[model samples]
Target: MSAGSPVNLVVLVEERSADEALRALLPKITPGVAFRIAPFDGKEDLLRKLPHRFREYTYYWRAVNSRVVVLVDRDDDDCLELKAQLSRMAKEAGLPAEAVLFRIVIEELEAWFLGDVPAVHAAYPRVSLDLVKRVKFREPEDVPGGAWEALEHLFQQHGYHKKGLAKMIAARDIAPHMDVENNRSQSFQVFRDGLRRLVSEEN
Candidate 1:
């Protein structure tokens, strides 16, 4: 682990979108830790396939540097269950829990990008206004007509709701949009730089 050497990271995600979002945002969020996105087919794939994949990559990562990170999204109500399973797997593999990081956004991945009820409706128009309001906690008047239609059209064009499409869209397209909207460039840099300074001081 020499200074200036890239920190190797292993991302355990199912789709290209998650890969892209993590690749774009993680380095900005944690400087000095360069990462690469490695995809697994899906949750079922993880169950059936991850042990082999993890074994293969774990050896590779240890050879380079004993640093790695795993990220996954909890897609539905089974999120907590998934985390427990992953935790058990990590322990069995002799990896500390901190070596893996998990994030379960409270809502669909799309919510991470749009943030507000109206913005989500604008991005996804086909959903019923009532449903959108229920999810986003905003009044119907807050959403303009035609916004939902446009969003629905966008989702359809992108083939959303199809198998594995939502994750792809979130990582590749929507996350970047949210990053920019949230001024993530500045925020991430600040957090990274501050963390580095703190680490150096403690050392």
Candidate 2:
């Protein structure tokens, strides 16, 4: 979506955690570029409603001067297939390929927290930086079994409450401190690059 007004970025995410994380990350990367989040109830709900959302966006594409970015978790699905499905939905909605972008976090959003260990340590100082520095995390977008569990495990090792893995607080805390340019997660890099491309084109 692109109207004659300044560029507006509409990002659709899986839930509150993603929205919280983006709130922390977007300003640093796209200052002066307006952005908003449309978060659904978890991944399943997002996937179920996404095609309809894309169709809805087509109606305002020109009027709003907005661009749609769809972000999802790669939870158990084939990444390429999921992307292709989203692309198909966009085309079906009569949106030009360039009008919308789709990105998936491999295992889960927690992987992004792992991408910048320092940010994680900063968010929850109780979690020792030394431990974070020593333990290796899998790729951000595609963890094998349980990304949140892995994160919780790491926290446990470092002395955070056994059951108090606060997702939103952690995202809010870590995002502000993350080095968007040097994140260790490939998926995170791709996400940032996509936003940069959109912002550059708008400029």
Candidate 3:
């Protein structure tokens, strides 16, 4: 949704790729709710600005009936501690906990795409459908090196994104084919659940 359009939710993501992915995913899960995405340059940028943004969102809530969702990547950090920090930032900004949902993508947004292998295959027909059956790919969030690295490898092996994984293009192409109910990443499921809960509460 456009910034001026009535929005039920405003998602704060760390990059354009995530914003692109959710642009496709949110409509499937959040029926009847209009939403907007605000993408920062990177994780550090988002973390640095969240307090001020949260404070603005507190005002936005009353003015536009919009709630907020803050999505970040866990990377190598401890998940629980990171989540607590986000909650603390919101609290400090005087943004009510109930008015915001903070979700961490266990490694990165690429992990969500890895969680739904069939969606990848749908977007890039050259990718192997048997990827889900592989032992290493069984748990997407647990992949060793890093989620994006793994995705880059896969795309290269399939002759797609040969030079590098074009994150925005990948997200835009794959997200539309994702099966929200079938995604295997626990983090993705948590994200979906939290978003649904937020929508349900308001609706």
Which candidate wins on TM-score? 3
Best of the two (2, 3) by lDDT: 3
Q: How close is candidate 3 to the true structure, as a TM-score?
A: 0.93
lDDT of 1 by residue, 64-100 (tens): 5434444454555476787687667666766654344
Q: What TM-score quantifies how close candidate 1 is to the native fold?
A: 0.57
TM-score order of candidates, top first: 3, 2, 1
Listed per candidate, the RMSD to the true structure in angstroms reads 7.7, 2.4, 3.4
Candidate 2's residue-wise lDDT over 73-165, tens digit each? 887799999999889889988987777889988767788888887788787787766644443554544444566887887777877746777
Model 1 / residue 162 / CA error / Å: 14
TM-score of each: 0.57, 0.89, 0.93
lDDT of 3 by residue, 72-128 (tens): 998778889999999999898888877789898987888899999999999999888
**How high a TM-score does candidate 2 get?**
0.89
lDDT of 2 at 154: 72
Candidate 2 or 1, higher lDDT: 2
Our tally of clashes for model 1 stands at: 7
Regarding TM-score, does 1 or 2 come out ahead? 2
